[model samples]
Target: MVQDAASGDVVAAGTSGEKKPGFFARIVIFFRQVIAELRKVVTPTRSELLKFTAVVLGFVVVMMALVYGLDYLFSWVTTVVFGVPA
Candidate 1:
């Protein structure tokens, strides 16, 4: 048997005499910890958020242009190989 350093409560190491926390008790404990953690979250300001959104939109637009260029190049090559219709 070991005593908790701060609380001085006796804690058993193994399953011999320990009572398990119930399911609902575990869920409540989990939510309490989540709320405590969320309280520490820092949200981005409006300017920072706008900058991130712009960067993402720019990247998507560049990717779309690249894909369209590749598609057009392939279509032109296929027409040349198979011969274009008169």
Candidate 2:
């Protein structure tokens, strides 16, 4: 038996009693489910979107700075160990 998550209702009794849907019916069902799920999505408000974008950009900038510092540190370490390349 399959239980519906959203409504907390039993959707199917048992697989033994029911015949499987045909290929086209299955396709239709899949599209219907996709549409249903899409309907549940919440769109961010303009302010919320801007805030999220700013946060993401800030995070990326911080990550880039960290990587750049690491690369610079490694380069310096290699230079010190190997002596300056000719």
Candidate 3:
């Protein structure tokens, strides 16, 4: 018998003594737990969702500008190293 870490239940494993739940039992238990958890989720209001979207978009734009600036700097360095064509 193996003791569960959180609940301290005496769980028995198969002959191998690995203490894992069987396949179908695990799937059913997983879905049951998922449904129980989904019942507790609190979705944000429309205004809050819009605010989050705006923040994400602003962050993405700033990252893009930073990447473009770095690309231009590297290109300038490479051009200078190889010298202007004419």
RMSD for each of the candidates: 5.8, 3.4, 4.2
- Candidates in descending lDDT order: 2, 3, 1
1-86, model 3: which lDDT tens digit per residue? Answer: 56666787877665345657789988998899899999999999999999999999999999999999999999999898998888
Model 1 lDDT tens row, 1-86:
54566787877744345566789987997899899999999999999999999999999999999999999999999999999888
Question: What TM-score fits each model?
Answer: 0.66, 0.81, 0.72
| Runs in model 1 lying further than 4 Å from the true structure | 1-18
Off by over 4 Å in 3: 1-21
Per-residue accuracy of model 2 over 30-62 as CA lDDT, tens digit each = 899999999999999999999999999999999
For candidate 3, the TM-score is: 0.72
Model 2 regions more than 4 Å off: 1-14
lDDT of each: 0.87, 0.88, 0.88
Instruction: Count clashing residue pairs per candidate.
Output: 0, 0, 0
* Ten contiguous residues with the weakest lDDT in model 1: 12-21
Indicate the residue-level lDDT of 64 in model 3.
100
TM-score of 2: 0.81
